[model samples]
Target: MAKPTTEVALISVIVALFLVSTTFASSDAPFIVAHKKVSLNRLKSGAEKVSVSIDLYNQGTVTAYDVSLSDDSWTQDVFDLAGGNTSKSWERIDAGSLVSHSFVLESKVKTMFYGAPAVIKFRIPTKAALQEAYSTPMPPLDILADRPPEKKFEWAKMLLTKYGSLVSVISIVVLFVYLVATPSKSSALKGSKKRR
Candidate 1:
């Protein structure tokens, strides 16, 4: 009795987790998915220059911000560097995943990702930050979008996509099975042959 009830409750909780994620619940239903990317491996100190791209999709509006996207590393003295100097020290500029910088304007109501309205864009100023730090190794990026994490956590994304439908289907299946297995009034169905 209690066992079956507990099992059902557990399933219900799992279904709910599969439905809603950290946020961006339905993010415009198919647009508005933030994708914050970065790079580190092939970054040659002075071999070439600061070059990277950080593009976020699925935006509901458009805005801008003076976000620090490129370098997370900085020394105490680096803070005093002029914006222009900071730009040079960073040596790289690319987009990052931080919605905090997004600014909303009355004129900008909607944008799109691929086809949907993009809410905001993170134009990372890598070179700018590099210049600010000047020769110091840029700190690791802390501006990536807090979403679609590792392989295991990523499964949650797929589950949430068709959550409503999946939940309905699962519920229907469970109900159907219970009805078939549970007798109408007793442990056995009427007119059924008993096992000899």
Candidate 2:
């Protein structure tokens, strides 16, 4: 009688685990992810330019609808829009799809600027509430002060870092060829001297 009761209890536990796994596996939803990148370029005219690029990816099983992206982090006095709009919208992004947006900001004044994350909003047909997400945040950027004159030593160091290995390889090959050729010439000279 005890063995029969233990078998019944084991069967009941197995049935419960199977039900829970199926319930979670049946859920299908759309998940949106955003990544933001910022680059600073120094121009020859003593102005700094900030380039911003944002990428949106849908990692969910279903398609996302009514997608929008907005970035209003820079102040009007600090940055001027050089090109491209800061806000964009799309009708939909399919499952496992990617979209990208970019803009450039030019700042003539030298100062430090703090940035905020870009906002992303989307909707699901089955859900009433609008889903919201934010792109990755960026740290503070220093647009402050004038860049000093470039030194020759600094330029040399940069060149060395870029082409030092290639130069070394060429030098080694040239040295090896010279050493091999000189040995044959010296051997011929020694043979002539012995004959004389």
Q: Please identify model 2 stretches exceeding 4 Å from their true place.
A: 1-27, 144-196
Q: What TM-score would every model get versus the actual structure?
A: 0.19, 0.66
Against the hidden true structure, what lDDT does model 2 obtain? Answer: 0.84
Per-residue accuracy of model 2 over 17-64 as CA lDDT, tens digit each: 664465367557777778889999998887898999999988777898
Model 1 C-alpha lDDT per residue in residues 61-117, reported as the tens digit of each score: 222233233332223321222222211111222222233222211111111111111
Most accurate candidate by lDDT: 2
lDDT of candidate 1 at residue 57, scale 0 to 100:
29
Evaluate all candidate structures by whole-model CA lDDT and list the values in order: 0.32, 0.84
